[model samples]
Target: MGAKMLAEAMGMKALLYANWERLELAEVPEPQPKTGEVLIRVGHVGICGSELECVVQRHPRRKPPLIMGHEFAGTVVALGEGVANLSVGQKVAVNPFVVCHTCRWCRLGKSNICERRQLMSMHRPGAFAEFVAVPAENCHPLPDHADTRLGAMVEPVANAVHAVRLTGQVLPKRVVVFGAGPIGLVCAQVAKAMGAGFVVVVEIAPERLAVARQFADAVINPAETDFLTEVQALTDGEGFDLALDAVGRSQTRRMAVDAVHPTGVAVWVGLHDDETSLSGMGIVYGEKRVQGSYAYTDDDFAMALQLVVGGRVEVASWVQEFPLDEGVEVFWQLARGEARHIVKALLRP
Candidate 1:
């Protein structure tokens, strides 16, 4: 069916992952954006780390048979009549998290962690399908020179935005990022661009560690040695100034705590499956501050776009494009860890 016809069409198939068990394509009704919303013709949609957990029935947010995809970029094929500023035919990226604009946190310019949020892929139909209907306010115009594929990355890069800004230009400082996944590697590059003295990445996956070396000052595989001991020795026994736990497990989180200097800061960006414990004694004696980060805010997305525009964080090599039909196979392969060579994969429609 034509793009326009599909937008107006009453029925279509939305990919569903029933709480991490299995993903099945289902023929269902098409969705129309309400007033103040816009309908996009999805072109390039990417699978995320969270999606993997959702596929395996590990993530808490993956509801039964929900249309999944929060990372996407497409053209505004149709607009709900009440919407303004964005027009049909305009290319845009969808920042899927919708926060209440009137909250105190929002007023303080911290809406990404707002109390009330309506996020896509969790509460509503996501962009993995051909079309997505979202609030017009969530749409962002893409750079004229930017590829639709770049859309898949903006969400993750926003995290780098928070990472770079959180430390506030603590120059000549060393930074370590745990987990060589997309967010970790991207944050490493952002730290370098922001003028960190040294940036290191730690991961267990050899393949992902290789990619991390491409962008980080150093890459360490924890399996080969005691990563914490090595990190302290590498920093002359003082440790790094900033440590990030991009890997959500309790092990990585503890590693982050042990890898920082006495007064250094550690940021927790990973979502974990178990209750995590902090070394209270370490916090008191070490004076280490641990902060938690979540999805991007609008300001974070804006900063990420500028970084891409300035050629600070290159994402051209991070994307792996596949036909939409291969979505199931590709997802399964990624889950089994066979797709290590592919950093991020997009389902091209």
Candidate 2:
């Protein structure tokens, strides 16, 4: 056998998406880093809501027979040829969004919307495995005192930072966030950290609501009370200065628009639904502004790291860690919505 074939014979454990709604622990060939890339031994990898959605919904973009994990931190074990900046045994967080720098959006510093953007789990092999090879530039160094497991959260926090930064509210007072999932919880905390006087989180799940209380100023169960009415009462009928929808359902999207005052900003960061219906006349008449937040920019990612390292964001209170071998069972639990108490789940490989 040739040298490459010999390497392919050596395998590593991974959580492989064999088919829709099926995650299996399988041994796969370890990856080799190409030029300008580095091979990393994953320390901890987060299971994002989007990955669960892809499995339950069988998303077309994320096909089967894939390794699906993007939020992760690991140590560089091997560097590819032509790589110079990174060294072996260095701890770092992975920014899963890879973009072509020549694209117009990239040139404009909007690499998230680059014409040729590729996400780790979707466009290439991801960090669910024992080893993942990523572009050298995509790795962000972690501080000596930083916990490697917390590094996995940097990507998601960067997402929250990007969403909140888009609102342009320097000191928003009366901010309401919809949903108490990882992104929503983080969004509420980010808003508060950014000087929001009052931050309320709306969630229907009691378990999630219980967790939200730690990060949000107030927690509301909309199923028990009227959502808009409570919003009006909370803001004294003026509505919130900024409203964020981390749940992409039609109702939450509409509520985000309705919950914000005229001239207030509503930022949508969820990807639950592709099509949503909203009151076009209400938006135009009320002069409300809406923005869609995708992934994060380099600056946003850096800020996320700062927030995490500086103790501005919470990590251990809600996130649960599981051995990589348990990923199959964890994936099933998350997909079935049975693990409501686990706001964020990470796999230690």
lDDT of each: 0.81, 0.91
Worst-scoring 10-residue span by lDDT in model 1: 12-21
**Per-candidate RMSD vs. true structure?**
2.6, 1.5
Q: Which stretches of candidate 2 lie over 4 Å from their true place?
A: 1-6, 169-171
Query: Which pairs in model 2 have colliding backbones?
Result: none
For residues 165-278, what per-residue lDDT tens digits would candidate 2 score against the true structure? 897748578899999999998898888788889999999998889989998888789899998888888888999988889999988999999999988888999988888898
Cα displacement (angstroms), candidate 2, residue 173, comes to 2.0
CA shift of 95, model 1, Å: 0.8
Residue-level lDDT for 206 in candidate 2: 89
Residues 146-221, model 1: lDDT tens digits: 8778866777888877866776656448999998888888888878878887898998888788788789877788
